[model samples]
Target chain A: MITKHLSEVTTKFNPFSKQAKTCRIFLATLPANARQTMKINSKVLPRDTDAKSELKIKFKDGREMQFDPDKHSIKDVAEEVDRHSRVLNRQAELAGS
Target chain B: MSPRLGICRDCLRKIRSPSSSTKRYLAAAAAATATTPAAPPSFEAQPPPIARFPRTQPPSHKPPEFRKSQLHRQYTSLLRSTPLLLLFQHSNLKSQEWVSIRRELSIALSKVDETYPQTPPLADSTKLQIIQAGIFESALRIAEYYKPPPPPSPGDSLATPSSSPESTNATPDPSNPIFTHALSRHAHDAVYKFKNAHPLTPLLSGPLAVLTFPTVSPPHLKAALSILAPDKQAGFPAPTRRASPGYYDGAVQAGVAKMMLLGARVEGRVLDQGGVQWVGGLEGMEGLRAQLVALLGAAGANLVGILEGAGRSVWLTMEGRRGLLEEEEKKE
Candidate 1:
C-alpha cells in the first residue's frame, strides 16, 4: 500500500480547527443549554478504539451519560439534564419553605 | 324712582341711550375735570369687565400635563415578555418555571383583551410565539437548575472563593480573583441561556403591523421556528432579508422574543450589598459587542421601532468601550 502524501493528510485534518462534525456533535452531546448549567469535566470519545462511536459526558456531580449525537436528537440530552435540574431545584425550594 | 337711589327710569335712560349716555358721561367728566384736573374718559377706551368663573372660565395658570407619546411609552417601558420572564426567574418553584411563562402570557393577553373593551382575538402568530418561548424556557429551567458546581482550580486554594453561585455549597470570599472570574463566567453564561430561551411575544406589535424581533439573529430565529413548527419552517422561505413591517408574518415574532431576551440579559449586573457593587472583569465583552451590533442593525426596522431603539444604549456602550482584543494591538 502507498503511504499517504503530507498535503492529503493535512487537508483531511487541520489540527488548529475543530470540524463541523463537532457542530453536529456538541450541538447535541452537551447542548448549549446544559453546557452553561452543568459542570462538564470532559466530552471525549472512549479509549476503546473498537467501541462504536459514542460521546462520554463527565459531570462535576460524578455522574456520566453516553450517547451518539448523530443518531439521537439533542432534546434527549437536554431532557435528561432537565430531569436532574428539576429535582435539585425542587429540593432547594422545599428546603427553603 | 328716587334720584338718590340711582334707580329711576330717567337716570336709567341717561345710561341706556347712546347719544344721551355720551352727553351725560361728558358732563360728568367735565365736572370731574374741573375738580381733579383729569381728562375726559373716551367711552370706547374703557376696558371690558374682567372674566368671571360664572359666564366664562378664569384664565388658568395650570401647566399642561406632560404626557409621553404612545411610541415613547412603548420604548421606555419593558416589553410585555420582560415581566413574564422575570416572574418565572424569581419563582421559587422549578416545575412552575418550566410551564408558567405560557400560562402567564395567555392570562395577560386575555386580561389586556378584556380591558381594551374591544377584545381582539389572539393572533395565531402570538399563540405560536408563546408556545415556542415556553418550550425554550423549559430548557432554560433545566440549564438554570441542573448545573453542578465547578471543582476548585489551583489558584483557588490560596483563599476561599465565592466561585459557586449555589449558596448552599459556597462560603463567599471577596478577595479571590478566581472567585471573581467564576462569578463573572456564571453570570455571562446565564445571560446566553436567557437570550436563547427568551420569548418574543412581549415585544410584538401584533400581526397587524409589520412584525420582527430586532434582538434575534436570522439563523437562530430560524432554528426556533423549526423547533416550534417544523412543517412551517420547511414550507416557508428562509427568513434572511429584513421583511417590511406589516408585510410578512411567521416565527419572526419568536425571533424578536429571543432578541428581547438578549437585551434583558446584557442589562443585568452582579451587585454585592456589603461593599463594592460590580467586581467582575468584562473580559469577553467583544462577543457581547458583536452580538449587540448585529442586534442593533436588526432592531432599527422591527415593528416596535421605539422598543428596538432602546437597544441603541447597549450597542453604543459596546461600541464606545474598546475591546481587549483591539487594545492589544494599540499596546504593542
Candidate 2:
C-alpha cells in the first residue's frame, strides 16, 4: 500500500544508506471504490473508540472521570449513608431474592 | 385654659350612675351599724363586691358529678359503715344472694371510682379491679390453705410444670400493668389522707389486726415490685407476663412475699400461730422482722439496700424506720 501511494518504483532499496531521510511525496491515488470504503472505515473506528471511553467512568463525586477504570464503579457519598443503604438492602433481601 | 375646671362627660356619668353600687354599700354599712351598735361602721369600708366574690379554686381536678361526687365525699364513712371485707365475707350472706350484693357493691365501687379518676391508662380500671379482685380471691384462697412445700427430694429440680396438679391450673400472668396500676390510682392521695388522720402510726404498725386487712393483694405486690425489683427483672414484670403453675411464677411469689413483708402479714400470721423467739413480751416480733427483712431481700436489691441503710444508722428512730414506707419516703 505504501509503495502504491508513494509511487516508489525502486527494484531494491538501500539496507545501510547513510543519506539523511527526506519526506516522501504521494504521486498515486486509490481507486474510487477503495477510497469510498476507506472513508467508511475511518468513521466506524472513531465511534467504537468513543463507546469504549464512555463505558470507562468513575462516579465518586456524583459523576467523574475515573483514572483507574478497574478500581471503582459505585456513586458513593458517605460511609454512614452507605452502611444504611446496605442495611436496607439486607432488609429487602429478607422480603425477596 | 385655667386647667379645664369642668369634669368630662364620662366622669360626670360615672359619678352620677354609681348609685346601684352606692346603695349596696349604704345598705351593708347601715346593717352593720344597726345590728352591732358597738362602734359606728366606717364609711370608708371596702365595697361588698370584695366580700361577695369568693376565691376561685383551680379546676385542675375534675369536679365530682352530683351523686357520684356525693358518694365519693362519703366514701370513707361508707367504708366505715360496712367495711370492704365485711361486704365479701359476711357469714350471713347467702350463696344465691351474691347477685344482689355484687350489684350493690358494683354500684358503690363505681361511685367511689368517680373520686379515683384515671385517664389514658392501659386498661378499663374498673374491669381491672374486678379482675384483680378475682385474682385476690384466688391468692387469698391459696394463703388460706397454703402448706409450705414438703421438704425437697432429689428429683425436685427435675420436676416440670406438668409434674404437679398446681401447674395444671396455669392462670395468665397477673403481672399485667393494668392490674397493678388499678391498685394505686389514688395512692398519693391516700398517703395524705392517712397522714392527716393518724400521723405515722399506720405506716409503722404492721400489727396483726392491720395485717389481716384484705388490701394486700397482687396489685399491691405489683406496686412493691416496681419499687423493689432489679432492672434485670426490669421495673415490674413485663405487662404481657403469663403465669405458670396455676396462679403465679417464682418472680410473682417473690413479689407477693415482699408485699407480705411490708404488711407483716407473714409475721402476724406467725404471731397468731406461735413461732420463733419472743422478746419484750411481743411474741417473736423481732425474729419475724429480721426474717421478713431477709425475705424481702430475696425479691430485689432495693429492699436489701434499704435494710442495709437502716442497719448502718444504729440510731434509726422508730418513727424513721417505717418498714415499706421508709423506701417509699426515700423515693420521694
Best-performing candidate as measured by lDDT: 1
Candidate 2 local distance difference test against the native: 0.29
lDDT score, residue B44, model 1?
Answer: 46
lDDT by residue for model 2 (B45-102), tens: 6433222212232111124344433333333222222211211111122233333333
Candidate 2 regions exceeding 4 Å error are A1-97, B1-78, B81-244, B254-332
Q: Against the true structure, what is every candidate's RMSD?
A: 34.9, 39.9
The TM-score obtained by chain A of candidate 2 when compared with the true chain A:
0.21
Q: What is the TM-score of each candidate against the true structure?
A: 0.16, 0.17
Each candidate's DockQ = 0.01, 0.01
Report the C-alpha lDDT of model 1 over A6-94, residue by residue, as the tens digit. 01100011111222132232322332233224432322221122334344544334455565544545456556655665665676689
lDDT of 1 at B135: 28
The complex in candidate 1 yields a DockQ of: 0.01
Q: Is model 2 an incorrect, acceptable, medium or high docking prediction?
A: incorrect
Error of 2 at B231 (Å): 24
